[model samples]
Target: MKTNPPAVQIVAISADEAGQRIDNFLRTQLKGVPKSMIYRILRKGEVRVNKKRIKPEYKLVAGDEIRIPPVRVAERDEQTVSPKLAKVASLADAILYEDDWILVMNKPSGTAVHGGSGLSFGVIEGLRALRPEARFLELVHRLDRDTSGVLLVAKKRSALRSLHEQLREKGMQKDYLALVRGSWPSHLKVVQAPLLKNILQSGERVVRVNSEGKPSETRFKVEERYAHATLVKASPVTGRTHQIRVHTLHAGHPIAFDDRYGEQEFDRQLATTGLNRLFLHAAALTFTHPNSGEVMRMEAPLDERLKQCLKVLRQQAQ
Candidate 1:
């Protein structure tokens, strides 16, 4: 089950107006929410600046985002707040697949799986509200914030339990599409390494290859090549956290557009090629139906922006 994330909707508080701090500006924008609630979200990391969370006194940039985590609202007041929530509610309702027991979505690049670090609401909560009849709706898995593609959600408690069991038992197949940093070796490389996570003092977490960590495996195959990089299909046989991201990096072909786990020279090369938003997508997923005994496969169509970027990069190569 997912809860409402911390978040705030943006309204113009003019640059010429009395200097109001970011939290104060939120106090102005969200009329009914309490100041104490605002402070709690900030401290817990549910609210973010841009997409990154910040300190309580962080100055207001003209276009900064102030996320308000979800509040326990009076159902009676929903009508009253609907007007204020119209924009986000509409955008958050996008669905990729829906059935009585399952839901899948083509999540956008900037949204999180659920809220924290000051997000008021995330896609999951918005979806849950839109389908309240569901006894339970749980994310079957996760994708990174800046990577877009298919995500699965289970709509019933039984379904969620069964699906999660399948994942734990390694009864699922996951395939990803990644535009990578450099021309890949023509031969396929199946990186079998263990991943160890490191959390920095600043509260960010990243993963690295370590002999003592959880065993991980990634099968990488070149799909196509550009002058400087290659588009590869990565299939993970094991799902330790950040398995694919770390494996690809260890293979010497880090994913293009990856903000973390990317090498510096390759990151710069990606910018020159006009690639953005970590060129990775949950392209296909296969698992057994939690309700039925049959197999199911799900795929997401390539979004056009990535396609256009590839076309331009191919042109540059020529």
Candidate 2:
């Protein structure tokens, strides 16, 4: 006979759970519930924090009260771990920094930040599996799965809030390295374009330049010029979805190997060169430490595969 867990439940946040997002908290607590259903309940105010309805991004603090309504949860199968998640866990060597309040990682290209849409699990889920004793952990910001570099995660709710404030105030700086097709112009250093995001009929997301779009900016500086492609550093002034990628396209120099918003022929040619992924890397990040109040700068080196692609290009240039 199978019995449901309970009709209603109340939980008090502890120190371990203090810095997590409410959505993440619910996911951990209601392990068998579909993520969509959890988000749906959150949208309907079926879940509350401190007796008030809160948005999904609301971070939990110590002693906070969470109210959970009834929902059918599938029985747990404690014995199984998804292979993809296990692989992500195994790659924990990429973690760059860790402390009581935050974690910094060099997330690899092709690994999603969190599981959804189609992925089974990503860095967050992998970290959860890697550190089962951790009470709270949540991404402070996101890097596109194909963009490898310094990724931040908060261990405490206060830290997450502080970091969020930094991002909102433009105090956080992120720099990226991209290999773009064609020779980059020495004088073309800035891309100030408003970008609008659209959803295609297939439910795929695409970004384009539009007068109605939000203000976006990216600063570009040449790193190295190759015969047919250029290595450059891209610093985004305003964070928007695919801002750098789309802005690069607008500059008439689409990033090498970008499947979306890229030159298809160039991508196919790069593919033959053994460059299989988008040539975008989150090379560095700068922000004030949430706990220490000290400005911190983190960097992630280019992976061997990306380095190899550059090596090939450099050889051809020579």
User: What's the number of clashes in each of the models?
Assistant: 28, 2
Q: Write the per-residue lDDT of candidate 1 for residues 1-318, one digit (tens) a residue.
A: 986665445444345533556666666666666454555566567776666776546677655555555655455775676632542455333455556688887777777878775766666776665554456878898887777788889888888898889988889988899987777887767889889988889777789998878888888888888878888989988877777878888888888767788777876876755566778888888988887767988888778778887888888888
Q: What is the C-alpha RMSD of each candidate to the true structure, in Å?
A: 15.5, 11.5
lDDT of each: 0.74, 0.86
TM-score of each predicted structure versus truth: 0.70, 0.73
Candidate 2 steric clashes = 2
Model 2: CA > 4 A from native: 1-82
